[model samples]
Target: MGNILSSHSPSPLSDANPSFHYLVPHTAYKVFINHRGKDTKQSLVSSVYHNLDNRGVKVFLDKMCLRPGQYIPQALICAIRSASVHVVILSPNYAESEWCLDELLLICRTGAPIVPVFWEIRPSDVRMENKNGVYAKAFRKHNKVGKFDSRTLEKWKEALRWVSLLQGFISEGEQGEMVEKITACVARYNEMASRQTI
Candidate 1:
């Protein structure tokens, strides 16, 4: 992960109702985990969600849902609005999905701090610059990557590095350190929000 942007706000736990939209009395950070549904590992998501929840970090995950007919867009937008952090789990299949790109675009537009978790797929699989790149072509063709050129494969690695840095997912050895950094980042934001009330 590159430099993780620090929030100027206080902690979220200081508030009475720390729900995403409540203007949490303290600094409440709602994190939206964006990823390909199929790629979300039970152990990984469950562990992370449990850990964050236990630590009072509000997490938005698709697995925790209502009935099939519920209005997903409204709920998702609301969650995004309430969150201060957005985590994008990047994988080959991630860019293949229109929904993931929409979420990424929305989060990016919102100015929320984004954390990209690089999964099994290499970063090059998601470059946005080249018109024929996987990510670029997908967006251009309305999220389709079937006709991508083979020559661009090498260039995709650069795109992956860019995306990883843009989203703050560091190399393998940095994973544990990154988590600690993120935890502190969230804590700092919550603290800042808390001070606003003082």
Candidate 2:
């Protein structure tokens, strides 16, 4: 967990829906949690998801939202599109998972308000500025393995850069404080969305 670190907001998101070919809204899940399951699912994700749920926030977390036999990609895509705000938990092993990277790419393209919580990694790591670092190392491995094409890899890099620039929380060694900040940020969006619909 971390404390709040306000960075300069990035440029306004493009109005275009880049992933429209694959994603379409199916439900009104207000918050989408994009995280590395291995790193934060049991710890930070569980904490945040429950916190939001108890506060009457409708959240789309794969573990809690997906049924036993549902198609995962389709379900996730719909959830991403339907959500009003996104909470991206960036952990050290986050970029190592192709699934997380692809999810992040989709989330970025959605143009939704994203609250990036740097769990245990720095914003520089996510921006890929640390050339020989963990985040960059994961991309290098992905490139070497031939699993993701150059274009897809580049898109992931771009998504990382985009998220790293957003005003977000940095880990200050306190999980409770970080969770409270994220919850407040998302609650504000939820309130705004509710008003817009009214």
TM-score top scorer = 2
RMSD of 1: 10.5
Q: Which segments of model 2 are wrong by more than 4 Å?
A: 1-27
Per-candidate total of colliding backbone pairs: 18, 2
The positional error of residue 188 in candidate 1, measured at the CA in angstroms, is 4.6
Candidate 2 residue-wise lDDT, 1-198, digit = tens: 011111211111222344545333355699999999999999889989999998999999988887765556777777888888999988999988877877777787677789999988899999988898789999889889886567667777777888899989998878988888889889999889888889
Model 2 CA lDDT for position 162: 82
Model 1 clash tally?
Answer: 18
lDDT of 1 by residue, 141-195 (tens): 5323434333233223333444566745533664456556555655555555456
| Candidate 1, poorest ten consecutive residues by summed lDDT | 5-14
How many clashes in candidate 2?
2
Q: What is the TM-score of each candidate against the true structure?
A: 0.60, 0.85
